[model samples]
Target: MTETQTTAEAVTTTRPTLLEARDLHVEFSSRGRRARAVDGVNLAIGEGEIVALVGESGCGKTTLARTLLGLERPTSGEVRYDGNPLTYTSKALKTYRRQVQLVLQDPTGSLNPRHTVYEAVAEGPRIHGLPDEQDLVSKALSHAGLRPPDRFFLRYPHELSGGQRQRVVIAGALALNPKVLIADEPVASLDASVRGEILALLLRLRDELGLSALVVTHDLGLAWNIADRVAVMYLGRIVESGPVEQVLTAPRHPYTQALMSVLPESPERVVLTGEPPDPTRIPGGCRFHARCQVLASGKAAEAGVHTRCRTEPLPILPATPEAQAACYYAETTTP
Candidate 1:
């Protein structure tokens, strides 16, 4: 891959953090067993920065996103916004949610078929009792790239194309003038052809509005395409995190390497064997040891790190301005 400067590095690490998850943990009980949905996660999103939380389904990315949006309460730890810790009171949450909006995965399900574009976009401000409803709605549509904003005002979601409906969903969020956008699987529901447009639209909004976003997804390729930095999640923890170019170009963690190798662009393939991740029974040492290609293939033993991989649990590290990995054998991998 050609080297390219990341958005954060292009400027400096001095960018103010807009949203943060500090030592965050979330747990759920079912069948008398506890499932660790989020485990000691610490992530920071800088102002105007785009961070992709990449992981397979059930890796806790969605739950983490929900925590960041104040939808789900954390069992331990804290989520802070703009340097202030989040409070759970109804009034406080209401005020907090106003500045931080959530954009869901499927736009079709997100938009009510009954409401026209204007009504959908105006819903937030109306609920917040904001003035100038008409102006807010129109401006939101324009920002979302629906030209001749009035053209979409009276149109129903079903009347527009899939991409247009998603834009309407975005317009709804834009109407609130949110500083941070938490998009859960933003392009997962769109056709491949239209994904680029939506991704490009997000980039434009970040540049034009200084919008900081946390994009949750299972696709590494999408992260490489749109994010300034990437955080790889496994089981319920971040295994590796850094700039998009650094992580995607030369991933150090075996789990991350396995993911990268499966990309269509990768010349060699590394298939992992054994049971899929089970949060309830996450392994003793490395949560990923059971499925780690390096350990399974005896590379860890060759490098004299096999004992550590099987018996030593790695710490839940932070994901941030500096690149780091939680794996002890990360340096053993060829970069």
Candidate 2:
């Protein structure tokens, strides 16, 4: 992979922190079986910054997003917004809900067919008792790139195309005038031709509104295109995270390197490999041991697979000037 610059150096800031999660864990019990969807994840999103959470499906990206939104309760750990503990019933939570919104993966599933675009977008303002509902809806539609705005006002979810429906969802989120947005696979269902356009809209929203975002996706190229920071997750854990360029170009974790290897160079390239392991029966320690090529290249036996990756979970250690990886063998440039 070609080396690239770090996002930290690309953007100038005073290290302003907007949201933080400390050792967050989310667990569930189904029919006497215990499963931990998120395990001891730590993350921070800075003001006006876009952070991308990239991982395979079932890696807990969506679960983590739900937890952050206060839609799902964590089994342990803490979530803080602007340094205050998040509470679902607190007065601050009402304010926080208004300041934070989500754009779900399936626009059709989330949107109501009974409501028109105008009603859908205006719902937030109406529920929150914000003044000037009509004006806010108009502004949201315009901001979402549905120019003229009148054309989309009477359209239903089925009346609009996939991309158009997604834009409506974004407009609805924007109507709340949120300071932070959590987009879970916002462009996953759109056609290739429309994906870039949607991504551009998101970038525009960030720039024009000064909004911070946590975009959850499995596409590295998409993350490269829009994210300021990239967090690579594996088996419910953040295996590698830091500035987008640093994590992509100079990956520290073996799992991260493996993920990047599959990205096509242009539009026609392919990198084939086995699928990731089952989350329910995740391997001990690293949880990525089953698919780690470096670990399976005849060196694992000598290194003792159980000893290196099954006994003790590795901590996320600093691997570069501005990055961290949770692999014992992660490379570092300095030292």
Candidate 3:
């Protein structure tokens, strides 16, 4: 492990939490039934920390990100900023929005084709009635790595490359001088060659501006490369969370292990047999039991973990002071 490797607990104790979600749950009416998109999630991002929220598609990572940004209201629970619960009233939300900006997955769809980079980046400041708009926009563009900002100011979205377009979107968010950024798959739509550049820009912004970020992505490799911590979500719940190295290099939860196993560079692959369970009708005990390899391996019974894996709801608790996993057999298994 490198010197940069720090435990989640250490980070928590040393730095202040900039944004947090406590016992958050989001549900929607689907086919006359309630579908839970986020269920009982507690997450915190400390100042200047880049925490990666990763899981497969539809695992509720994006939904959680939206809730944190106040874009989507939670069915239950509350979001806090600087240890105070958020107020979602129109004015309160507006002020909160200024402090926490969102970066969408698809920059092309998010940015208007007719709008020039200047207009896109200035929109937030204009809405908030902030003064010095032009100066702020120029600084934002520069901060996002679009040097000689005036050259790109009049360029339309369609006129720029994919990476440049994404930078413009980031510049728009930075224009607000937000303390936190909720980035939903920030590089998912860009070319592979440009992904590293975008990721580097995020790190630079965090280091230079003391910005904290909740990066919602499905790429484990991205987590390893840039994130200080990684939170693994499954069926609307966080199954495992800890420092990136601890969680990725030695995953405890069966679900997290399965995800890591599928990474192309992984030497051992653990292929799951079934699709993810339906969110509308989540399992009774462990939501992952239906697809968990550790539980079905017939070894858990010997390890004395069979009963809880089948009948008890496993809460996300500390497997160690710095790491957590919501699996009854996590400590017993070697995954």
lDDT of each: 0.87, 0.79, 0.86
The segments of candidate 2 whose C-alpha lies over 4 angstroms from its true place after superposition are: 1-14, 90-92, 266-282, 299-306, 316-321, 331-335
Query: Could you tell me every candidate's TM-score relative to the true structure?
Result: 0.94, 0.87, 0.93
Which pairs, if any, clash in model 1? Answer: none
Candidate with top TM-score is: 1
Q: Provide the RMSD of all predictions against the true structure, rounded to 1 decimal.
A: 5.2, 5.6, 4.9
lDDT of 1: 0.87
Rank candidates by TM-score, best first.
1, 3, 2
Residue 274, candidate 2: alpha-carbon lDDT: 72
Candidate 2 per-residue lDDT over residues 1-335, each given as its tens digit: 11111122112223577776667878888567667788767778888889999998888999999899888888887677876779877676678888789998888997999999999999999888999888899999999988789888998999998888899999999999998999999999889998999999999988899899999999999899999989988877788888998888877677777668777763333332577665566666677766666566655555445356655566642222257776644532325
* Best model number under lDDT: 1
Error of 2 at 93 (Å): 3.8
TM-score of the candidate numbered 3? 0.93
